[model samples]
Target: MPSKSSARLAALTVAAVCSAASTVVIASPAHADAVRIHDIQGSTRISPYAGQQVTDVAGIVTGVRTYGSSRGFWIQDPSADADPATSEGIFVFTGSTPKVAVGDSVTVSGTVSEYVPGGTSSGNQALTEITRPTITVVSSGNAVPAATVIDARSVPNAYAPAGDPAAKGSINGLTLRPTKYALDYYESLEGMNVQVANTRVVGATDPYTELWVTVKPRENASRHGGAVYGSYASQNTGRLQIQSLGKASDFPDANVGDVLTGTTTGPLDYTQFGGYTLVARELGTLEQGGLERETTRKQRRGELAVATYNVENLDPADGTFDEHAAAIVHNLQSPDILSLEEIQDNNGTKNDGTVGADQTMSKLIDAIVAAGGPRYDWRSVDPVDGEDGGQPGGNIRNVFLFNPQRVSFTDRPGGDATTATGVTKVRGKAALTVSPGRIDPTNAAWEDSRKPLVGEFVFRGRTVFVIANHFASKGGDQSLHAQYQPPTRSSETQRHLQATAVNTFVKQILDTQKNADVVTLGDINDFEFSDTVEILEGDGALWSAIKSLPRSERYSYVYQGNSQTLDQILISPSIRRGCDFEYDSVHINAEFHDQISDHDPQVLRFHP
Candidate 1:
């Protein structure tokens, strides 16, 4: 989440699928213990109970998301009556890995909590995360379907009873309304798969052009986790959800009734509806052949490297990345540590007039691979069903890519790209923790930036930290910086908070690790002379590539005829001794005003 400063600009995306039905009836039960999956639609209500010792559920896996290793998925609720998309629900685990597929029935056991609302936008309510009562699934399979749905009064601690008069207009089954204090919740369930039924499609609308599907729970819906793994709408006006969360461009010409199933790997949210909320995770369709081949591709050298790039809103206006793959790869060489900024995820158009982010990433990947780089493996940060943080994949964010030869990764915790963390930002950065031996030891202070990624790397005999940061632009609150304003809780002055966070973050890192070798690079959005840069440098002996060059030629990015050293490569002297890195200011847009990235390339040429 963008530190609190950028909350205002951060849009609200997901919401509770509520029905304008009757009030929910509250009741105290004999046992307020078992984690149950209940789906209440019209007069039908399905509830399933599970064992008290089970902690994770795995059935016909539905949504599968991966945050490094923390995974999440939806096991089919035997009590389901509607579509599996609506009936199967959510479960998360940092422990063992579960393998299943869509349409395949299974059961999982895990803790359950009620999902809180994130915010409201254009009449749609946003959810936080899937909330559930805890339980573990002992076993699962093509279980018998639910015969009937019990009243809300049948379940213990029913927030809204099945007959409560006040629970009529609920959001995602819960009576709660959307608010700003909501905490977006998500689970990490990668590699697992599942099958479901009773799904009905809701047509495209603002905030969501895909089909909004809802599934009824099975007869034993309450057996394990809650019902409703994920609810996805068709992406194309015709239907782009037939395949996994794979790229729309890579997908075959979508035919009606095509079964699209893939792995879930983003955030999922729950919204209040019928006294209960909806549970969901973002899913990516599994690739047919290329993905398997890429998965087995060898790495370049010894130590793994991670790189970040914006790819400059990578989307062809003429609709083709296949033709430009080679050229694009030449510009964005594969790196061990790949952090991509502004990558798209969904298949719909946003207010910004661009195709879906998912389409963009897919095309970029295909083009990159076709150009003959190490078959790089990639992953995206999915969104919570209820906490739909405005737009798909919780708003345009970065995805990480890695070469197995250099390094191997399991799971990485993902977050919204533009979450406003109170005093920090209006937009957030996607970050992850690395293994201890993966990097150098002197770079441990790299975890300070909320926008920063912390990962363990095994480099040369020791480990270190590597940070990728993109700071606030000269835009947003341009008037405030001119006025030299102080920080405030209001979203209006978020830029100040973003800047302050960077300043304090850098200081705290150095203060804590005096002998560390730190590297903070990316699109700072401001020139070397701006307050943003000075704030980042502080009283320390800060060093950047531009600092070593003549003032007139130090600029790395040129905007509107004005040259500015916005893209930088800053490092602590300790890590500079043996490193052979060069800041290649490609002047990307210098030749074409509309190049992919406004910023130039900053290359770090060190033997892995």
Candidate 2:
């Protein structure tokens, strides 16, 4: 519970903090015409003056940042233009520390550029900036522009407008509608000095010295203070990323539901990871929420408990085994059968071609028993070296740990990484051809992704089938706040194929035994209402147990500020017909700042 997820947002404002200042003299080209700050930041997401040189761009230095590689200062034109759509501030990127100070009226002569954070393929909206600048101090000691207050009243409830068709639904070229769409509202104020006052922290502070808060505290708000992302329409426009212009060690360690009690002021900057980020020059006080991890109730005597948890690429190298063991034992109540995703190889990402996870598996088992939990036996198919894609060298795959005291594993041999397991009738009962076997591992649907691990277990003298999956990640998809409105989900194509493959295999089992108890669960990497889930539930083969929870409580993951469903448990007709199962998306890790994993484990209990 010491490390927080940089959440791939390590680039949020990597270089947004630093200090120093000076003056500059430049040999002005004839094309370097004096212009206003808004001229550089046009009415659209992209700048009109891109690739052109501009001179005498006058503004008061609102924030001087000399941190990281992209060091520079944010300048705001005190004399505002009449257009509300045009931003009056912009970032002047100086590869080195800036020779200027706050309130200095500096004119930077540089090529107007659009720097897409995380590069062009990252799906991040481009940041309009002035790079390779020549700075001229017009004057010093001038008052900085007053920061525009951003609260519930300021942000529009609507998320965004549709992207232009000509640009393939990219909203970048579309004119800003600041009053109507929240995305447009934030875009209109890009690089401008903005402030959120006394806001509630909806996201925990990460290792990157960043946190998230919602200006509109009541917008589909969870009881725990996190925002709910129910659909595309409910993007939670009030949520904004907060990063500070200070050292990482000095940054506040905040948990979900904590309050930042004061005016947190900064320039509105777009980032690679979390979209709109406010790089704070001055931070507010962090008031602890007294938030604590949740523990799911133990399974009833007549019921069996099953759970799925993504250990976030766990390996022997990580120090989180004890913490993870504690979660599986104390928080999850040591479910009878637990499926763990991202169990790395023995060497823990040391790519000498080792695929076996015996060391990694044994370490976790030892820790679990030490944590006052039942001694468990595990089953997993060793993935073909690096065919399962995760961290390059980490041969991560799914593993099932079941208590021998509670349930017996039906171990059918011949299950290897490359072989696909089939369902066969064993005395009129459904049985896996190879227990702890891979499902369609050779199928192209699992290419470069973790294949589904299916196993047969006996609980209370009844046979049960479990399929643990870690589907293809959403790595290549366009971000929610991308230039394209309704950003493209190119990564979902693989997930769809994966779902169909799993669905077909589940059908095979149900075909063999009509009353088979099957629990299909893991990190789906898709939402509850998504097409992938629909495919998984095709022809009523399976029903997502997450839907059983109210919309607000269905989430097992929190990204940005949205409590969402990325992990789920689905059941076959037999389990669904009874409708007597208990499911809990245990809230232990995702909500806290110091988390063992980015995903919360989901538990399901029912009589088999």
Candidate 3:
């Protein structure tokens, strides 16, 4: 499954194919005492019956998950209690695949436990399950409960209730108001059979055969029909993730803006990657929207187009070179300058002390040339073996690809992996001590991350400084659905220091020559509105071009269900003040099912 942060679940599903007739549970004669699923679930986030033993918890099997480590079955009571806040169904955690079938009427005896996905440290909400169960087959071929329809009207507008101030904003103890909050609504139907009709796909299906759809069609809807996560306050409450109980090979290949036609029925379950998800027993039919890749217009005669693309750990071994080249030639229109991130070394992941990327860079350049783009020349300092924190042996680093026909690179000697690049004044103009160099490479901020690659390029006899960066990723951050309100972004601390260092370096260049043109662009691994971007734009010394685009068109990457911004190009005062710049978040890759990279390349065109 995709690892998450507002970023990215476990669990399987069942549908109409698994469910049979409406039935009620009869208390076992052995243990006359029985409990409704709702009574065990209670009205709070944590189950009221937690750690306590429940006898004769009876219901009909609605779904059976026969694969994965957490193999289990879902059972729902047809005769549900009137309380809307409590669930009518529950998951029976069987370590191995249970022999139970969909229509079997079963009575379970086990300890009620709150099982947290991804562990307690993940800050995820716990799932109420019946673990270490002793199950009795009362009868066979009974019908399950009718699925609760989850439509726009049924889900509330509010994302979640505020965590109690005393308990540090945790809503665990708060009573669920299903009609008022979306999280509460999902909580009420946890493990219950549910369905959505004609839902819009917001997140494209990933390798794990999982996708996301929104119950509310218009909630923060983007131009491309995906949900736009504009701010922390607007959580897009209607978004629900979908994963199949069926075979992965049988799942439909879907893209953004596509439709899940008719009804998709599944058991609602809380998961790790995604918060609340529909484990689909029966998936809806795919209705293609035919989303085509977007191609930006070529730059004007006087405009210099500089683009940034994360080739997604590209190596010579991957077959995506042709596709990446085509996107650069046709979709990006062959820019004058290109900043490439995640470019792996030669021999790709074979370790063996091979730090050179000549073969890898050569293949991409050759492919670009074959695709009708210019025969681009590349410049980069190979990282010190495994210091850069990408795939261990991949030695991923940033590289600058410039069209020699359009731009000239000022190649000064003495630049190496660990040597810090310095700025100097040559004849009253800002000049790099080394043309293609690493900026403050040994600094603590870049300890295990890709260092900033600063290079000097002359476009039309004007010196333009372009710094390519691939900052620390958001690996350890908590998800948006974390139990704690306003989940913490722990990964931003390193990016903060890195941003400060880069911002300070930009100031040094500007201090030497106030009118110097600088373009700072790459995979920021953060949102446009994040503290990292703000730090990079300190005191108007630099300004991000991404903010120039409208809110709906601002995103260059999609995580989970949110169309968010991660790649950005920030310009110095000289470039932003002229009002001659145009920025495009080229949507060639991110919104497609068959994408070459997870990030969509961003292009900036301006007169230097």
> Against the true structure, whose TM-score is highest?
2
TM-score of each: 0.38, 0.95, 0.94
- Supply the TM-score for candidate 1: 0.38
Q: Which residue pairs of candidate 3 clash?
A: 4-8, 9-273, 13-279, 14-280, 14-281, 15-281, 15-282, 20-143, 21-143, 163-169
lDDT of 1 by residue, 402-474 (tens): 5555555544332333331111111231222322111111122212212433343434533334545554444
Using TM-score, rank the candidates from best to worst: 2, 3, 1
Per-residue C-alpha lDDT of model 3 across residues 41-123, encoded as one tens digit per residue: 89987876776678899999988888876778999988988899999999998868898988899999886777777666677
| Candidate 3 deviant stretches above 4 angstroms | 1-33
Off by over 4 Å in 1: 1-308, 315-328, 351-362, 379-394, 408-454, 460-462, 476-496, 506-517, 550-553, 577-580, 606-608
- Give the worst 10-residue stretch by lDDT in candidate 2: 17-26
lDDT of each: 0.35, 0.87, 0.87
Ranking of candidates on lDDT, top first? 3, 2, 1
Off by over 4 Å in 2: 1-32
Candidate 3's error at 59, in angstroms?
Answer: 1.1
* Clash statistics: count for each candidate: 180, 4, 10
lDDT-wise, the better of 1 and 2 is 2
